[model samples]
Target: MRDPYIFSRMHRIPGYLDPGDALILRALLGHQNASGYRGGAAEIGIYYGRSFFLIERQLRTDERALAIDLFDAGDQKSGRKRLESFTERARDMGCVLSEGQVIRADSRTLAPEDIIARIGRVRMFSIDGGHGLAHVRADADLAAATLSPEGVIVFDDFCNPEWPEVTAAILDFLRANWDRLRPFAVSQKKLYIAHTGIGAEYGAALDRAEGLRRLPRAPVNLFGHTALRVSHRLWQRIGYEILCRMGLGRMSAMLY
Candidate 1:
């Protein structure tokens, strides 16, 4: 399938997310749509609105997105600026600022109650804030408490060498909440998780997609459940870039 959204707009929103990851997001959201799931989307760390906008694009008209971040503070000055830029860009893309919320706060301090009060259970929540172990633990806890039964939680930077603490914290959380959640897929930049009972369905859905199954996969003991780690190799990454420029990034899944 050709993804006009990513090819024509995704790159314009600056962030660390790869195009392949965006494809996975699309697939996951598509599954939710097919299953008739309805809930808000959320992101703990929205640098500008790159991934946030991508998530927003998938939301139904009634669904909203919640963006939590430390905007306009200390080293996040650039982030604050980008956030403003994203607002304008989003407007240009036909999104209303009022459709979602942009909260400027340290996510570690936000209680689960605070989140639920603002936006009920979220169908898709991304934890990408503060790479510290403590921060990751707190974010994970909040995400868990506010996740919908059929929802998915995405942990960013898992296994990334630059943020080794994130991996440790995530594994710890998984071990502690194994009965509550289980990982189904791990991409180059994120790990996809869901309620344990629902994880198998997601895993099967992803595995059945010819595009997704083509990615490199490895067996992983995610806390306790067996899972697949799907990621791009060096050559695949280069090929993805080329395909994206060719406006065929969505089809790059076959390259694997």
Candidate 2:
């Protein structure tokens, strides 16, 4: 299957998505599309539209995307710069976003109804907004409320040392909504989850996808549910870095 975005082109945008994560997300979206799932995509905390646009590119013509972020909020210099760069870079890259698709606000204040009102039910919802436990919990709530029956949620920075709360928040949310949601897969930087009814289906499909290489380790047990850990091999990661340094990022991304 073709990638949602050229690696080199995505690399030019500023954000924390790696090729392996991109590959996993792309594969899941492919599975959804193949299964005839129909819905839009949404993300919290869009840092210059890196991952957001990646998912948007894969969306069908009738589908749409929504993004929420505190661009230029609190008078932070970094936020202002990111807002300006996000606009200019998107324009230069020729990515067309519709009105009200990107919102400049703290996600904590937004309701699921607001999100659904803007983009309808979502097939893929990304939570990379605030790292605090409350923030993550709130974002997860929004995702759950707006998700389609077979929708998936991608949580960033899961189990990262820098943001221990992200892991805690996700675990807490998962346990509370155990009957409704089940984790299906996990990458180094993100976690993939879906409704319990279809979690196993999604996991099994991903386990068979050539784009993802399941790790040798045993499955992760999260509150009686299982999540497969998948990522590129060490050699592929090294090769990707080397090729990018050699100005062959687009070709190197094929490894993912």
Q: Pick the candidate with the highest TM-score.
A: 2
What lDDT does model 2 reach? 0.83
Summing lDDT over every window of 10 consecutive residues in candidate 1, give the lowest-scoring window.
Answer: 73-82
Per-model TM values vs. the true structure: 0.87, 0.90
For 27-83, candidate 2 gives per-residue lDDT tens digits of 888888999999989999888888987888778988988978988633254546776
In lDDT terms, which candidate is top? 2
For all candidates in order, the CA lDDT equals 0.80, 0.83
Stretches of candidate 2 off by over 4 Å are: 2-4, 73-80, 213-218
Off by over 4 Å in 1: 73-80, 210-219, 242-256
TM-score of 1: 0.87
